[model samples]
Every structure is written in C-alpha cells, then in structure tokens.
Target: MILVSYFARYREQLNLGGEKLPLDASLNTVDDIRQRLIARGGVWADIFSESNLMCAVNQDLCRLDQAVEDFDEIAFFPPVTGG
Candidate 1:
C-alpha cells in the first residue's frame, strides 16, 4: 500500500489528511499517483491542476517523476511562502 498525504491548504481543500492506496504497477511514479487522483475529477482534478503543486516522498521533497514503492509515504502540498 502507498500512504498518500495532503498538507496545509491541500488538506483543508480536500478535507482529507491522508489515505492509503493499494500499490499497483501502473503507479510507478509520483506523477502517476497524481494522475490517478486527478482522474477522480471534480475537486480532485481541480486541486491537482495547479502547476505549482509540490510533492514529497518518504518525507523528502522530490519531483513528480520520483519513483514510488510499496509502503512509501507520499505527500502533496502547495508552495510555501513566508515573510
């Protein structure tokens, strides 16, 4: 299984903290997982459509192309800004 999490605005927007998804061969990378979520349409599509969306794998910030493995933790959030 893959543990997917949403942080900050993403969590609030989705009204979800995280979820576990069954591991699948088709979900080879972070982008693939994202595409899966986006495929859900509606709010899922809208939230993931942002070009500035950020991702992390196993607590390490990574690109969308980052490889995903079973039992890995994936997180998504918007870019951070502070004064």
Candidate 2:
C-alpha cells in the first residue's frame, strides 16, 4: 500500500489528512496518483489542478514523474509563501 498525505489548504479543502491506497499499475507514478485524486472531482480536482502545488515522496521532495512503489509515503501540499 502507499500512504498519501495532504497538507495546509489541501488538507483543509479535501477534509482529509492521509489515506492508504493499494500500489498498482494504475498508480505507477506520482503524476498518476495526482490524476487519480483529480478524478475525484470538486475540491479534489481544484486543489490538484493548481500548477504551483507541491508533491513529495517518502518525505523527500520529488517530481510528478517520480516513480512510486508499495509502502511509499506521498505528500501533497500547497506552495509555501513568505510575506
């Protein structure tokens, strides 16, 4: 299984902090996982559609093309900003 987490506005909007999903052919890459979330529609689609959103894998910063595997921890969050 893969652990998916959301942070900041993403967590608030989705009303979910984390969830587990089976690792399968349909979710081989970070982008695939993202697309799946987007497919949920409504708030999910809006949050993930943000081009500046950030994604991480196993606590390390990663790209959308990054490979995903079983037992991996993936995190999605909005871009940080400073005033």
Candidate 3:
C-alpha cells in the first residue's frame, strides 16, 4: 500500500486530508501518483498542477521522477514560503 497526503490549501480544496492506494505496476514514481490524483478532475487537476506542486517521499524532498515503492508515504503541497 502507498499513503498519499495533501497539505495546506490542497487539503481543503481537495476536500480530503489523505488516502491510501494499493501499490501496483501502474504506479511507480512520484509523478505517477500525482497524475493519478489529477485524474480525479475538478479542483484536483488545478491543485496538482505539476508547475505548482512539490512532492516528498517518505519525508524527504524529491523530484517528480523519484522512484517510489510499496508502503511509502507521499506528500503533495505547494512550494514553501517563509520570511
């Protein structure tokens, strides 16, 4: 199983905090998981736009092409902003 989490505005906009998906051949990278989320359409497509999103695998920042495996935790959020 894979754990997917949406943060900040993404959580509110998607009307979900997190979800779990079974790991399979169709899902292999961080981007693959993101594409699946966007397939949900509506706000999901907008919120998960590749240009505006940041992804993390197992708490470590990573690129969309990063490899993923079963039981990994994937987090998606907008780029961080701070003073």
Candidates sorted by TM-score, best first: 1, 2, 3
TM-score of each: 0.97, 0.96, 0.95
What ranges in model 3 sit over 4 Å off?
none
Q: Across residues 1-83, which tens digit of lDDT does each residue of candidate 1 receive? A: 99999999989989999999999889999999999999999999998988999999999999999999999999999999999
lDDT ranking, best first: 1, 2, 3
Where in model 2 is the C-alpha error above 4 Å?
none
**Candidate 2 backbone overlaps, count:** 0
Best by TM-score: 1
lDDT by residue (1-83, candidate 2, tens digit) is: 99999999888988889999999889999999999999999988899889997999999999999999999999999999999
Query: Whole-model lDDT for model 2 versus the true structure?
Result: 0.94
Predicted candidate 3: what Cα RMSD to the true structure?
A: 0.9
Candidate number achieving the greatest lDDT relative to the actual structure: 1
lDDT of 3: 0.90
Please write out the lDDT profile of model 3 over residues 1-83, one tens digit for every residue.
99999888888887898999999998999999888888989888888875968989999999999999999999998888999
True-structure RMSD, every candidate: 0.6, 0.8, 0.9
